[model samples]
Target: MIYRSFLRPILFRLSPEAAHELALDSLSFFLGAAPIRKAVAARHRGWPLGPIKRFGLEFANPIGLAAGFDKNGTAAESLAALGFGFIEVGTVTSEPQSGNEKPRLFRLASDHALINRLGFNNRGAAQLAENVRRRPPDCVLGVNIGKSHRVAIADAIPDYLTSFTAVYDVADYIAINISSPNTPNLRELQRREPLAELLRALQERNDELAKDKSLRQKKPLLVKIAPDLSEADLEAIIEVALNANVAGIIATNTTVSRDNLHASPAEVQACGEGGLSGAPLRSRSNEVISLIHRLTEGGLPIVGVGGVFTAVNAWDKICAGASLVQLYTGFIYEGPNVAKKINQGVADILRREGFKSLDDAIGCSAK
Candidate 1:
């Protein structure tokens, strides 16, 4: 309540990117201390049900901070203390590079949305892996990896393979991001030929690493796709994922299309080009989730993203077949309590609806 009514307006006053940096820095500063993290977590324990087992790992809660928020693995402890079930950090690359120029992130206040062409800017996988290794957080951490902007499309496999190995030990699971519109040709990897080679290579290495770790388990590999995919495109990707034995899919990432927006042409045009996310993305992303759920027939796990702003919105995705839900734009609009609220509300809805567990809510609408 206070976030949209009070804090959001003030933060929205600044440039989108700058405001994000300020908020992240402030949180990081506080969480860097032990006492503060414990104090914060103690107060926001949320609905402490038993551990949630998904994606071959246990999540303390179903709500997680999406990729692109903690792009450097910097403040997992702080974010976890805020009551997120898990925190996914980074769209890191094999090599570091400054992303697209300034004014790349824009706000569509009228639509309660944002358009960002931040280009997956981060400190590269090696640096991020080191950061995670040095001070591992207590909660589940998934690392999202992408190709370096400089890497050629043909060489993307090796490029992504480099990152897969780098963060293999640190991340609970690896999310292969093939849908960020900011990077040129990144989505091409979502195609069948490229996706097959990519998933196969990574899984081979995943097997090798599993042997290396013999003591520990092999981390699951998940692919994140765009919401704008055609049915044929989706089928091809699904076939590849199943054949390659990939763990799951994150459906979907931001969209370049600006259709069905509440913002006027002039106002939306003013925001220019970038991926559109938040309320405007809710239905389309949910549709993608449903399609994938049907395509896989509840066999493949999906981590839903895009436009989940409230408990109802999150519940919509769960009912449409998302095993777990994540949010980035919603966190920006609703503030830190978004995850806590969604988890608690889902628990309430589950009980009221006569569902025995969170799993019962999965695909209720679609089924």
Candidate 2:
């Protein structure tokens, strides 16, 4: 209520990207002090519902801050103090790039959505690793990697491998992002042959690196997919994912589609050529999570993300088969308290629904 009634009005007045940077910078400064960070964490951390164990890591809660929110790993610890169980940072490319031209991020206020073509902009993988090393988050950390813009589609595997190697030692898991619409031809990597090859190569490296480091467990690998795939495409991608032995699937990135929005067509079209995310993406993302759960028979772990804005939205995804739910656009609209509120709501709902644990509630709606 405070955020929406007071803070949001002032923050929303600035351009979307500018507001985002300002928020991040403010969090970084205020939370940079250890004592202040701890105080904030104490106040906001959700109740101690049982921890969620997925991909060999135990999450304090199922709600995570999705990738793209902290593209450079800056303010990650601050974000964690805000109550996210985990923080997936980066979509960091192997090379540093300025990204698409300015005015690339647009807000469809009426729709409570955003459209962005910010093309994997970051300080590059090496710098991100350094950032994480210097100020690791308070919770689990997943590093999301993408092919460098300069890298050709054909050379994507090696490009991704470079990033994977850089962040491997620090990340709790790695998210292979082949789905951002902002990057030209990136989604094409989702095609069966290429997708399979990419996952297989990454898995092989994961094994080698684990062995070389003498780590007891290999780092989990997850693939993030686009929301625009056809049924057949989804099925094929699932087959490839299973074949590659990846640990999990992040059921969505964002959508290129702009259907059924409350915003004027002209207003939306003006934001042109970018991925759309937020309230408009909820149903389709839930549908994709349900389909993956049904198809895999709940065999593969799923991280559901899209338009999640409240606890009910997160619960919908959990019941649709997502073992964990993440938020990006939702965090923007709902404010910093979103994760703590959602986590508490989920625990309440679990008991109300007569479920003993979250795992027990997974896919209840689908069943």
Q: Which digits, one per residue and each the tens of the lDDT, describe model 1 over residues 281-350?
A: 9999999999999999999999999899888898899999999999999999999788888878888888
Q: Write one digit per residue (lDDT tens) for candidate 2, span 276-331.
A: 99999999999999999999999999999999998999999999999999999989
Off by over 4 Å in 2: none
- The superposed Cα distance between candidate 1 and the true structure at residue 38, in angstroms, equals 1.2
State every prediction's TM-score relative to the real structure: 0.97, 0.99
Q: Which ten residues in a row have the lowest lDDT in candidate 2?
A: 43-52
Q: Candidate 1 — worst ten consecutive residues by lDDT sum?
A: 41-50
